[model samples]
Target: MKQNLIADYLSCILFRITGFFTCFLPFNISLFMGRRLGDLIYIFDRKHRVVACANIRKTVAEGGDWRAATRITRKAYQAFGQNLIEISFIPRINKPYLEKYINIVNKDNIEAAFKRGKGVIFLAVHAGDWELSNIICANLGFPFILFVRDQGFPRLNRLLNSYRLKQGAKIIYKQAGPRQLIETVNKNQAIGMTMDQGGRHGELVKFFGREASMSTGAVKLALKYDCSIIPTFYTRVKGPYIKVILDQVYTVSRSGEAQKDLRDNLQRLAGIYEKYIRLYPHEYLWTYKIWKYGKERELLILSDGKTGHLRQSESAAKLIIQQLAGRGIKTNLSIQEVRSRESRQGLISFKPDIIISAGSSISALNYRLARQSQAKSIVLMRPSNLSLKKFDLVIIPEHDNPPARKNVVVTSGALNLIDADYLKEKSERLKRSGFIKSALSPLCIGVLIGGNSKGFSISGRLISTVICEIKRSAEELNADILLSTSRRTSPEVEQVIKNELGGYGRCKLLVISNEHNNPDVVGAILGFSSIVISSPESISMVSEAASAGKYVMVF
Candidate 1:
């Protein structure tokens, strides 16, 4: 009990301090202070900052740039801070202030709607200066009721409500029954409501090209009272000036079917919100998770326990995810690493829209899982035993000379996860982490040594021959070598290569084994290497080298 009282007292004291700054400071000074506070919040609020960046990445403009998202996210925090500070000034607003600072555009629309005996539903969203919108309607002598959700802080909530009441706006908490809303409409009063936030159990509707749960309360109330649902918003024009835009008013559709009518009306409202938000994107609330559930498609990736195969499969899936995002769809990716048929139990709970895999080992598993989940099956490389028709999409390399088929997508080289941007980012990370010397980055040659495999044998002579060729090439190109072997490399082969490259001036050999492996080395090699040498045992490694646009030599 003592702790609770102490916390409440501290909260009230902090609230009073904020009120002092907002209430006493000049408008411009308060706005400036609010922006600084916002920047501080952006630094300290780590969780919300992550959520905001994720939301921004999910909705960045075409040709997605990370820097653009960063700039907008920063501005979004500042806009939110400005909104709060301006909302604090609501209690002091009157007719003179509205006339001087607020410009009401399209007043004719509201007047025409008011002529109809049924009340008007001012359908709005959480955009610029939305808290002050009620003052616009109330000061103009419109009988107004603002339906608000609690801010989760009791004292802060009451303080904000006091401001609203002082402006002659009636308060109706969302938790209170709809009886109050109906009574207000029956009395021919304007009801202000915002339904832009995702509502629990709300119907899924498209917003910003992605699905989000949207509340249909405004449509329902309009249908019930035969009222006009006016699309309205107040956008901040400058530091202390605002423009209340009264956009096109809509009538609820009474298509006789409740579900259809509700969905159509809700979609209409969401469309309007999307237009305004796009125009003033930074002004919209971004901290809220807009693309909530019911908007994501699931993709399952089947791996064959090979690093090269996993990289290829992941590359293709990454491209598909990007394409989906371009079309306003969200994707959830799940990987199932299958060593044998016994791994089937791992996928029982996963329901996928598409299944993708590389290597012939998991072809049968991919087919079975796709069939069971009713997902489109996509496989990379030609299968050894399974029929091609079993899979929906077959992506094969041009070197394989696959037969002409409707489901086949033949490419020039193997798909790989490495791209220019990815390489640059990884290189920066490696430089920061001190794994690769910054001076050697431009002239590094990576040797990807694969050992014995099916239909292939690695002899001691072959090892010596490859090592001599690598040494000669390194001398000719004046490059340092970053050599690594695969799981299939024999101990004799490792010793031979280690002995040869060990005494060389600038060479690093990583012997792969059961317990000792560094996944990051692969990224570092791809990022820094100007050229790559590979053994013929693994075609995936060769393909990845060529895909990254590196000069490749197969020994």
Candidate 2:
């Protein structure tokens, strides 16, 4: 603890000296020295350099190239250095210096906004000498309130605040709460706030196709007070010259739904930020962890090669995401289809909050991945080779009749992907594709046949009987038949069923696996059919058919 004080004092002295040198030197000379210092820091500051490179990789288009990421990371450090040196010159800036070195485009925007007397909310981000913005505004003789967050070091925060105050700007620390902001706005003073920083108490918005938490305070204030929010940014134009772009002003709706208004307004601000960042990618703060929340909450999906298992895992993941949305917990989901242990190697890089999968083929892999990543494993079926304790959550079908345990969740049938919305969507798509004989078929019968599986066998006579019964039943009910077979269906059984249903004009579709394996056939039939019939062999197929919420008959 005693060493901390000595180190802090030394750090303060170093900062003061750096400030003195930056202020004392000529603009161009100071910039060159700052860039050199940045290059030196890029070599020395290992942790921040790594972070900056990673962030650049996440945000840029060709981010996968290490060379590209490295170059950008170095430039990002240099930008930071240049910004710091310019901040040291804030006290020297005045109206005359601004006229020579600073150019504020679209000044008429703020001038017109001031005529309304509603207190404009200036939305800006941490990009390109942002400190100069407040000073320039104050030097323009506008009453401005700058809202700033407390820095890590109290002495440095004080020093920074003193510079802003000296430029005729009112400082409002974030911890002072909304009362100060309300009073300032009531006095018809412009408020400047940076909206891109991650906050625990804010809405999750997409910044660059990835979810990042954004502060909604500006949006809320704009909506509540009917204020105009002008999206603004400051960018460096060559040596010692700054260009401040004041974008078009936007007004938020008083939609009476506060949550939605807040989200939409924040989304608009985030969109503007994304645009400028794309324009000046290196000028933004790339070292900051913009996707910290997304990285923390990941949902990993492990899939066996079977279509049934993959569908089950994906459907359960969608449901989990839906539930999390209700509680305001945004999640990042990744699905991987694994055929062997080698396919699991990629899981080493991602640490998930929960790992989910279905079928016995992927149970062991799921457990291994969950243990390695320290995530909760959720198995969708009864595992044949592993103990129940190995999984954090085991969802078993009632037919298995597994022993009761704290971690076990017994479901009526297997979890399936046949939800009402999916059924409606696929059915409409198939109707438009001319696959369905009649989109408005009032009595379409679906036949889902499966072949040999655990304790079950398919025979020619059984196929004949099933086909005869289906034809007889369809005739009695005056229904159109849509029949399909699974991968497990035997060729001989398929032939028998086809022969039995020969010359039946009412059989609208017959998707024999031996001929063509159209993946959408089964889903389309299940979605559009009024009734479904399944051969009792594969539980997954039967469960999915029943989940369509039609009258399902077991043959």
Per-residue accuracy of model 2 over 144-250 as CA lDDT, tens digit each = 88888866566666777888998999888888858989887777779998788756676878887777888778888888887778889888888789889898877
Q: Tell me model 1's lDDT, rounded to 2 decimals.
A: 0.78
- By summed lDDT, the worst window of 10 consecutive residues in model 2 runs over 57-66
Each prediction's TM-score against the native? 0.58, 0.58
Per-residue lDDT of candidate 1, residues 1-555 (tens digit): 676666666766665677767777888888887788778888888767656755664564333344566687898888778877777678778888888888888888888887787888998888887878877787888788998886656776777788788999888998984999999888877999887775667878877666788877888788778888889977778878888888866778788888888888889888887887778777877777675555577798998888888888999899899998997778999998778656765565565668999998779888876654446799999986999999999999998899899999998878888878877776677567654433673588888888888789888788898888878878888888887787778888878876787677767434354336656566667777888888886778887777778888888
Q: lDDT of all the models against the reference?
A: 0.78, 0.80
**Clash pairs (backbone) in predicted model 1:** none
**Which pairs clash in model 2?**
none
Lowest-sum lDDT 10-residue window in model 1: 57-66
Question: Against the true structure, candidate 2 has what lDDT?
Answer: 0.80
